[model samples]
Target: MTALPQERRIVTAIPGPKSQELQARRTAAVAQGVGSVLPVFTARAGGGIIEDVDGNRLIDFGSGIAVTSVGASAEAVVRRAAAQLADFTHTCFMVTPYEGYVEVAEALAELTPGDHAKKSALFNSGAEAVENAVKVARAHTKRQAVVVFDHGYHGRTNLTMALTSKNMPYKHGFGPFAPEVYRVPVAYGYRWPTGPQNAGPEAAAQAIDQITKQVGPDNVAAIIIEPLLGEGGFIEPAKGFLPAIRDFAAANGIVFVADEIQSGFCRTGQWFACEDEGIVPDLITTAKGIAGGLPLAAVTGRAEIMDAAHAGGLGGTYGGNPVACAGALGAIETMRDLDLNARAKAIEVTMKARLTAMAEKFEVIGDVRGRGAMIAIELVKDRTTKEPAPEATAALAKACHQEGLLVLTCGTYGNVLRFLPPLVIGEDLLNEGLDIIEQAFARI
Candidate 1:
């Protein structure tokens, strides 16, 4: 196939006639609860642009929620996945193991943090990996209680729904969630009542105290967290907070798991977000960008902990699908060859500079926080009051959509604008996306 022009071009309305028609068919067929940010359907996507059915190219700042870090159609990813597709699709790893699955496990062992011997099990999604991580943690420690943080998003499954903090969309009506999971306060610097400077130590102390008194340290099996909170407005925990938490888990023998599904695979300027503070987790769950858009997830951790499960205790029918494994390998190769880690850092610098300036100019931008390419701007009705501006966020997102720029809004309060452009996106397209954001915010 030939290359796309690699520029944003609006030949029709945001949702042109073709897309509008498709949207009608979608409404008739798809469920009402399943939400989509934009009405336009994608025809093709690569690099930083998504070509819609109407033949309009929109600058992609979402990267499919950070799944396409190497771009939607990177050469290596497509080549390997296609080759695997042609060769054979599946022979369930549980029944008949394949080299691709083992290779992915080996790569994850080497790529994740720490020098200790590690092991991994593949799955179909981030939530599955997280649930498995919890399983292994419980099996290893022989404990039942699990700990999670405020505003955290693990997944939509029953057990993961309990692990997740937000409720409106993920867990509003889903009732009778798993029982052993516990919730605690996170070091959300912007919203911490005591102020950001003291958030780290105070929040850590609060969480530990709660766990000790309520759940009891002896019963706690694991503590899972997003080093950089994703759907929770991309809040980076206050300095020392993560290290303190990790140390606490270690001292108590509770397995520490880092949910890097959205923050890993070089999206955070590091191989994993846990590395920002030199923190090492007992286990790490990863997905999204791991396979360059393919569906794959993994639970990697210390060999002993990972091996604690019985022979038949873990795995799924489609876990580590050959094609997805191949895609993951290709994605890893792209990250190494393209040096996407450095690219992510550069993206952080450019975006922070631009967003910080925007915040200075606009009082609605209450906080601009996040590391590397996974950045966000939280909108507020007033900086002093810090009231969430969900309406303004909706308006801004609509404005960008009309202008042919694809952006995503997230946050527990639904007041944040997140940007996650593919690592291979050109500087010009990245800047153009930012320009659209600035202009859209100005209109708002």
Candidate 2:
């Protein structure tokens, strides 16, 4: 089979002849509720690029929202998955335990931070992993309250929806959310109430104090946060803040949860984003990009805490499917063999240099921040006022899309453009994507 870039061929309009034909059939034959990110339809993808039904091959900077970090159609993942399929598909780990499932859990135990004894439970999606993490925390602490940060995104399930910060799109009509969920302010230095450049320990301290007084430390179960907020603009916390929160959770007998669903698997140049702060969480929830695009989410934590869940309460029908486990095993191996951590770091190096130059050249480029392959640029009206320029963001994204680059925009205000290129992306392709970004910004 030909690998991802089979050869760039944009023979027709962006959506092309075939895609337009499919779109008509899609609206009539497919569910009316089906949604799409772009007007073009994908026919194939691989190694940091996606080919549309129209045959227009575009450099993929989004990576399916940071899911295919090892690259789509990864050699090992494809081979291992096919090998497993030849054996059997489903046995249901809960019904009849499988070696692959146990093996994946064992690998997670060894890979997750902390040399202390640990255990892991696998689920089918990031939301399930997040829900299970809460179950573990609640069972371990015997508490009722769960704390989530402002502008932080956990998942889409009912409980996670309550845990999420955004109101529209995620929680607009979804109401009567799970009870006992509390919202707290995250340390977003850029948009902190204190001031853009002034966010620091003081803001973190203030949020901590409020939670302590209102929620009561004794009643709180877990304080879950994204080490680097993913869906909430990819905003990394200010220094001293994560360490401080760690100390607080420890002192209060509350479990600290790090939601690394979008930042794990060497995506952020580290095994886990929390590693950046030298802080180990009590429970870590991960998914997206794990298992090389296969469905697998995990909750890895201190053994005692993970074991607190009732024996029958921690499983799912499709959790740890054998084929998915095989894919995960291969994905992890591929990541290590490729030395993707070093590659992610190299991407950061190049992006910083080029994007910094763009920042100096463009007045609308307000702030650029992120780690490794997960970098982003915040658009603004002016450097002095710092008003979010969402309009410019839309224009820039449209320009990039029209020019054969796949980019994604995020942030609470929808003004941040994020880059999540696969770790296996070629340096030439990576720079080409960045060049497209520069050109897009220049046009804007």
Model 2: per-residue Cα lDDT over 1-444, one tens digit each: 236653345567777778888989899888865576567888778887788877799888998899899988898999999999999999899888889988988988887888889899999999999999999999989998999888999888899999999886788787879999988777888777676455658767877998989999999999998999988898999877888888999999999999999999899898888999898998898888789899988999999999998889889899889999999998899889998888899999999899999999999998889999999999999887889999999899888888888889888899999999989888888888888899887777
In terms of lDDT, model 2 sits at 0.87
Clash pairs for candidate 2? none
Clashes of each: 0, 0
Q: Once model 1 is optimally superposed onto the true structure by TM-score, how far is the C-alpha of residue 404 displaced, in angstroms?
A: 1.0
Instruction: Write down the TM-score for model 1.
Output: 0.99
Query: Which 10-residue window of candidate 1 scores lowest in summed lDDT?
Result: 1-10
In candidate 1, how many Å is residue 425 off? 0.7
Candidate lDDT scores, in order, read: 0.94, 0.87
Q: Each candidate: RMSD to true structure? A: 1.0, 1.5
Q: For model 1, what is the C-alpha lDDT against the true structure? A: 0.94
Best by TM-score: 1
Clash count for candidate 1 is 0
The alpha-carbon lDDT assigned to residue 59 of candidate 2 equals 86
Q: Which ranges in model 1 have alpha carbons more than 4 Å from their true place?
A: none
lDDT of 1 by residue, 8-106 (tens): 999998899999999999999999999999999999999988999989999999999999999999999999999999999998998888999999999
In candidate 2 the C-alpha lDDT for residue 81 amounts to 93
